[model samples]
Target: MMLIEETTVADDALPVEAFKAHLRLGSGFGQDTVQEPVLRSFLRAAMSAIEARTGKVLMQRSFSLSLTFWRDAEAQPLPVAPVTEVTRVALVARDGVQTDVAEATYWLERDSQHPKVRAARACLPQVPTAGAVLIAFDAGYSAAWDGLPSDLQQAVLMLAAHFYEYRDDTGLSAGCMPFGVSSMIERYKILRLGMGAGQ
Candidate 1:
């Protein structure tokens, strides 16, 4: 199984100016813009870190999940949370032929923690032997930073600021997450009950 990011969040979607404000940096003299690239990188890294730790996608983007077979024919849980829509489902043959599944054949089952693609009838379209099924979907809390929950938005900015403050510190340990960031994202983490781990 392979999960591919079909579309990434646009650079403008990131809160560059907001981050500058958070950092209390000066503006209008063109000095703040000099560190824009570095700030952007930190924000991206912080977002990735937060997303990795939590099941949530803070920014809207497209994703494609390709698998040889469905874990369940009637319902297949998506990889991420807050899915806005399921764009397409296709079966690709080993010979590279593509067959698109009609929208009426399936629907999205929305959940905060686990969104799923469910067959409208009894089961999802079958995957050809030696072929794969591709599911394309969009997932995120919102397309803009302001649309996110206040806690998540603050977590991102906090983590990004942590990165910025420690940028030149060679002694920093790897995977160093601040306590505040973790506290903010704690509720967003996906918890397992040790049952039906197969899913």
Candidate 2:
């Protein structure tokens, strides 16, 4: 199975001013807006790290998940959280024929932590032999940074600040993450126990 992010959050949608305020940086010092790019990069890095750790998408974006078959015919669990909508579901056959699943056949189970695609009836439509199923959906708390949870927002700020403070350090470990950020997002991580089928 493969999951691809089809769209990303826009730069203007990020809370740059809020981040600057959190870092105690002045908005305009003289006629120059110095350090804006650096701050944005750190924020992006922090957001990426937090999302990787938590299996959560901080901003609403489009994604496409491809699979050879369903883990469960009744319901197919998605990898990301807070799925806002399922835009499309298509089945591709070995013969190169593609069929779009009817909208009435499936419905989105928008669980906060574990969103899923559930068949409206008892079972999902039959997938063709040697074919792949593609599920396209939008997932995340919101399209803008302001829509994020308070704790998550704070976590981003904290992590970004840490990155800023340690920018000149070249000895940090590859997998190092701040304790505070980890603590803030501990409850958001998706814990899986030896399971393979469902994400």
Candidate 3:
């Protein structure tokens, strides 16, 4: 089973109230089985832990964790693939930036099919990227019209258009999906933030 945990901000960190409006935006997509309230509670606790450890709120971020399980029955080997579970979290900053985080864990069982094992292994690396992209897109678009340079703004628009085109031509509509645009947008926002801070 997939489990999600929420975190609370640290005493020295940004106020939780600051991010409340943006926090709920991405939760709809990351969690599948858990109730919204339960997920929120989990997130609150998780964020608190993170803030305590890191000394900053995980503003505009999303993450996921995955677990795999398998069981054996009988003297004779039963052929069954392991079950994989994934958990994802998205965080948005008060300023509208967002980040995605995800994790996957694998468990091996006796008498498991080789193909199933391989497929599960393959999906491991992809989980984090998928979560990150979703978070970045949301954060990027939400702040796209803000005080960005003309060139960078144009690039963002182009990326947006391309994402739509990709969705139309290929069954892969990155633009239409919540996570699709997030990764690129997140990067852009980071660059802008860094530049502004430097100046």
Tens digit of lDDT per residue, candidate 3, span 1-199? Answer: 2322233223323222223332333445665334434334434444333233322223322222233222211111112111122233243344445544343332222221211222234332232322221211101111212333343333334433343235347665332323433443343331214543311
TM-score of each: 0.94, 0.90, 0.18
Please give the lDDT score for candidate 3.
Answer: 0.30
C-alpha lDDT values of all predictions: 0.90, 0.87, 0.30
In model 2, pairs of residues that clash are none
Among residues 3 or more apart in sequence or in different chains, the pairs in candidate 1 whose N, CA or C atoms overlap within 3 Å are: none
Backbone clashes under 3 angstroms, per model = 0, 0, 42
Of the pair 1 and 3, which is ahead by TM-score?
1
User: Which of candidates 1 and 2 reaches a greater TM-score?
Assistant: 1
Q: What would the C-alpha RMSD of candidate 3 be, to one decimal place?
A: 20.7
**Candidate 2: RMSD over Cα atoms?**
2.1
What does candidate 1 score in Cα RMSD to the true structure? 1.5
Top-down TM-score ranking: 1, 2, 3
lDDT (Cα, tens digit) per residue for candidate 1, span 1-199:
8988888878888899999999999888957579888989999999999998997888998999999999899999888888999999999999989899999999999988878899999899989999999999999999888999999999999999999998889888666898998999999987665795624
Best by lDDT: 1
